[model samples]
Target: MREIDRLEDELSPLPESITRIRKLISTLELCHHKAERWVTNIIEAIGEGDTAKGLGTRTAGELHPAERDWRDACVALSAWCAGQPAASVEIKIGGRSASCLLSKLGERSALKEWQVQRLIERIREFIGWPRSMHHGDSVYVFMEECGADFEPPGDAECPEHYREHEEFWKQTMQTRIHDTVNGEAADFSLAVAIDVMFPCNWNFVGNLDIVLGAIGGELYAAQPLTVCARNICHVPIRERMQTVCRTLQCSLQNQRSENDVDSTLLELLGDVTAPQRWLVASLDKTIRLQLRL
Candidate 1:
C-alpha cells in the first residue's frame, strides 16, 4: 500500500509535465509557421520591386541577415530536440507511467517568440517598411499593390456591357477579403457582386484567382465586342469559359461541395443589377445548358 501511494505521488506530476510539453510543442509549431510565412513574404516583396534598396538583388544562396538569424535559431532548436531522449518509462508505486521526454525544450537555446519577432522587425526595417501589427499585414499590402497592375488597360474602349458595371469593378478593388479554408489561407480583393452571390460562407472561398477567373470569363462572354479592346479576340469565349471552369473544378474538386458551387451560380442568376445580372444569368444558363448537352 505504501509503495502504491509513492507511485501515485510520482505519477501525479507526470501529467502536468506532459501537458506543459504539449503546449510548448504547439507554440513552437506556430512560431515555425510564422517564420516561414515571413520569409515567403519577403521574397515575394523583393521580386515585385517593392524594396527600396538593392537588398532584393541577393540570390537564394545569399539570405538577408534577418533570415540567417531565423535559420540559425531553427537549426539550434532542432539540434537540441534531436539530442533529447525519445521517451522515458518508469515503474512506480502507482503502476507504470510513460512520458515523452524533451531536454532544454524551453531553455535559452530554443527559438523563442521574442527572437522571431525581433528578426521579423529587422527584416521590415531593411525593406524601409514599418513593423506591421499583424504578421500577414505586409504580405497583404504587397499583394494589393501588385494586383493593381493586373487590371487590363484600355477600359474606355470596352462595350456598354462592360463599361456600365464600373461599380462592380470598384467594389472588387475596395473589398479586402481574408479567410483560411482547407488548411490554406487566402487573402485578396473581391468584387461586391461576388460577395453577394457567394452562397456559402464567403470565408470558405479559399482561392480568389479561381473565382475571379470564372467571373472574368463570364464577363468576357457577355460583351464579345470587348475582345478587341482587351486584346483577347483570338480566344473564343466558350473556350475561355471552359478553361476557367476546368481549372476551378479541379481546384475545388476535393475541397468544396457541389451544392456550394451550384448555389453560388444560382445566386449569381437571382439577384443583381441590370447589366451585371444579365451577365451572370448568361453565364449560369450557358453552363447548365452545356452540362445537359
Candidate 2:
C-alpha cells in the first residue's frame, strides 16, 4: 500500500476510480482473514482431539475397528468442507490401511519430523500407499556427473526447439544428487536432492539451506552448530560468496546418490535474489547477507 502511494505521487498518478478498487481489496482481505482464522481454529481443535466440539466423538464405533479412530478425525474436517463444519475429504486407499504409520501419527514423539516422514515412506513400501509428495520438506541438489552429456541452452542449430522449454533445459544442465536416507530399506528415498548451480555463485545462500536441512533430516539428533560472520567487514564479499558455494559443492558431493546417479533436478527456477550470472561481477551478494542465511 505504501509503495502504491509512493508510485501514485511519483511516476504514475492513481485514477479517482482506484478508491473503489482499494475498498474492494480491503473487503477481500477481511474475508481472507476470517477464512484463515476459521481454518486455524479447526486445526487447533484437531490437535487438541476435540474434533469439532465433540461432533465426531459422539458417533459410536460404526466404522471398521481398524479405521474407526481415523474416521473420527476425518468427520470434523468433513463437516467444515461441506458447509456444516465437517471433515468432508475422500481419501482413496489401495493398501491394507490408510497409511503405514497411521497408528503412530498422533503419538509422534518417538520419531523426529523427518524420521516420521521417512518411516511413512518406508511403511508405504511395505503396504500400498500414496508416497509423500511434499516438496517443501524435500531438498533438491544439482551437480555435473563425470563425462556429463551436456547441452547448452539455445544451441545455434536448435535454438527454436529449446525456446519453449528453455527453463526445463537449464534444470537438465546437471544431475540431481540423492543418497538413501535408510540403508536397510533399498527402496527408501532421501528427502534431499542436491545439484550444482555454479561455481562462485552467491545463490548458494539458498543451496546451503537445502544441504544443511537435508543433513539435519539425515542425522535427526545432530549436534547444533552456530554459523556467523564475526569479522564480516574484514572479509571480501566475493570470498564469502565462494565459501558458501564451496560448502554447498562439498555437501552435495558428500550426499551424491550411490544407486541413482542420473536423477536430474526437476526444479525449474533458481534463486533469483542471488541469481547465477555468467559474469560473476553482476551477482547479487546483498540478498545472501541481508537474509542472514
Candidate 3:
C-alpha cells in the first residue's frame, strides 16, 4: 500500500478524541521548549544588565565596560543555544516537571532561578497561562509537569482533515521524505500545497504538514550540517533557506493529478467540514516522508 494510504487506513479506525489528545500532547512539548529558551534569554539579559536592546555585534575590544559585559553575556548565550539540545529543556513548576529532547545536543541541566522565573513568565504569556489553563490533571500535567502546552485554539473544533490521523509528527515527516525520494507523485504537490497555505504568519488549514515537507526537502537537498540562522543560528542559514525554498518550488511544480496545486488548496476555503485529523495526519506523514527519503 502507498504509505499515505496506509496511514489513512491505520487512522481510519481510531477514535478522534484519542488522536486529538495525542496531538495536543505533542504540541505542548514544543511550546515547553519555546518557553524555556525565551526565559533563558531574558534571565541572561538581566544578569548582563542594560540588555533591553537585543544582542548586537561589537568589535572585540571596542565597547564601554558595561557593553563589553553585555556582549560577553550574549556570546555565552550563543554558545549555549548551539551546544544545548532541545530535549534538555526542563521546566519545574512547583513539584511538576515537563521536558522535551528534540534539540538535545550536549548536557542536561536546569537554569538559574532568575532564568527559570523569566521562562515561567514567558510561558504564562505564551499560553495566556492561568486563564487558558484547564482545571483537570490532563491540562496541568502537560503544562506544570511537561513544561508547555500546544493545544489547538480552544474556541474552534479541530477540522475534518485530521479525523483519522495516527503516528507522531517526526515519524510522519520521515515517511514523506521517503515518498519524495521514491519519486511518488504526492510529495511534490503536497509540499507546495503546504507552503502556499502557511507562510510565516499565514495560518492556513493543514499548514504544519507543509512546513514539515519543506523542512524534509531542504534537509535532504542541503549539505550536511547546514545551519538554520533564524531557527538555529549555529550554522549557515542561507543553505537551509535555499533548501526549503527549492522544496517549495518543487512541490508547486509537481501536482499529483491533472489539477493544479493551487486549485486543490483553494477548494477548502469555504469548506470547514473536513476532519482535522486528516490535516494533522497529512502533515505528520509529509514530515516523516521527508526525513526517511
Candidate 4:
C-alpha cells in the first residue's frame, strides 16, 4: 500500500479519536491564526517606529502615522482571519517555556517543552525569549548570551552606552538566533520573523535590510504547530528561566506578556541592584503584553 494508505489504515479504526483530534486541531489552527495576527500587528508597530524616527522621532506610546498604519493593518487582517482555525505548540525557546501557534507545519511534530529545549540546546541558539525563561505562570522572557565581562555601553545615569555596544549586541543576537534555528526551518520561520519585526538591535547583527529580509524567511517558512499546550504546561519555571535575566532588555520589550512583567517585578524585589528600586515606579501600560481571546 502507499504510505498515505498505510497510515489511513492504521488510523481508520480510530475514527472517533481522529474526530476528537481533528476538533482539537481546529482549535489549534485558530490559535495559530491569532498568533499570526498578533505578530503582524507587532511588526507593523515596529515599522511605524522606524518610519517615525525618519520623519522625526516620537516617544514610545505616542502614535505616529507609520504606527497607525501598522496597527490598522493588523486590526484589519486580524478581523479577516477571525474564526479561522490554526495550529499551536508549546515549545521551549531561549530559556522559557511558552506556546506558539502557527498557520502551518510541514512534517515534523510540534515539540514538547523538553524536546523543544533539547533541540534548542543542540543548535546553540538564542532568541528574544530565552529558553525556560519564565517569571510566573505566564510570563516568559530571555536575553542575549553576552559574556561575564560584557559591560553594557551607556552613561552611568543616562548611558550613551547604547551607541557604543550596538554593533556587538546585534552581531551576538544574530548568531544566537541563527545558530539555533538553522536546521528547523519552520520553527526558525516563526522566530526569525518575530525577531526582525521587533528589530532587537541588542541581538541582531548586519544591516537593517538584512534584518528586514529575515521576515520574508519566516513568512515563507511558516508551518503548522503540532505540539499541544498541555504538553508544555508542567515544565518548571526556574529551569525555564535558567538563562533569563532579572531585567527584560531591549529586543524583548515587544514580546512581554502581562504575566511576564509581573514576574519580572517580583524578581526585582529580591535583586539588590540599584536599578531594582527604580523598577517599582517604572510600571507602564506599554510594558504589558495583553492577551486576546
lDDT of each structure?
0.30, 0.27, 0.28, 0.26
lDDT of 4 by residue, 193-242 (tens): 23223211211112122222232233232222222121121222322222
List TM-score per model, in order: 0.16, 0.14, 0.18, 0.18
lDDT of 3 by residue, 1-293 (tens): 26546655766774554344334323321112132232223323222322332223345445343223222322332334445433444532122221221121123233222122222332333233244534342131111111112112223332243223312221222322222222322232221222122111112111222232233332232211111111122222223333332332333334233332223232222222123333333433433332332
Query: Which regions of candidate 1 are displaced past 4 Å?
Result: 1-19, 30-293
Per-residue lDDT of model 2, residues 1-293, tens digit only:
34334433552343333332222223221112132233223323322323232223336534433233223223322222233311223332222222221322233232223322332332233222232324433332221222221222233221343345444333333222232221221111122122222111222222223333332333231211111221122223434334433333322344333432222220111221111111111111222333233
Better of 2 and 3 by TM-score: 3
All candidates in order of TM-score, best leading = 4, 3, 1, 2
TM-score preference between candidates 1 and 4, better one: 4
lDDT (Cα) of model 4: 0.26
In candidate 2 the C-alpha lDDT for residue 12 amounts to 35
Better of 1 and 3 by lDDT: 1
The sequence of per-residue lDDT tens digits that candidate 1 reaches over residues 1-293 is 34334543554544443333222222221112132233223222222323222223346456444444333333332333444331332211112111211111234222222222322332343333443424454331111222222332323232343245444444344444443222245333433223222111111111212332333232221111111111122222434344334423422233233432333332222333222222222322333343221
Rank order by lDDT, top first? 1, 3, 2, 4
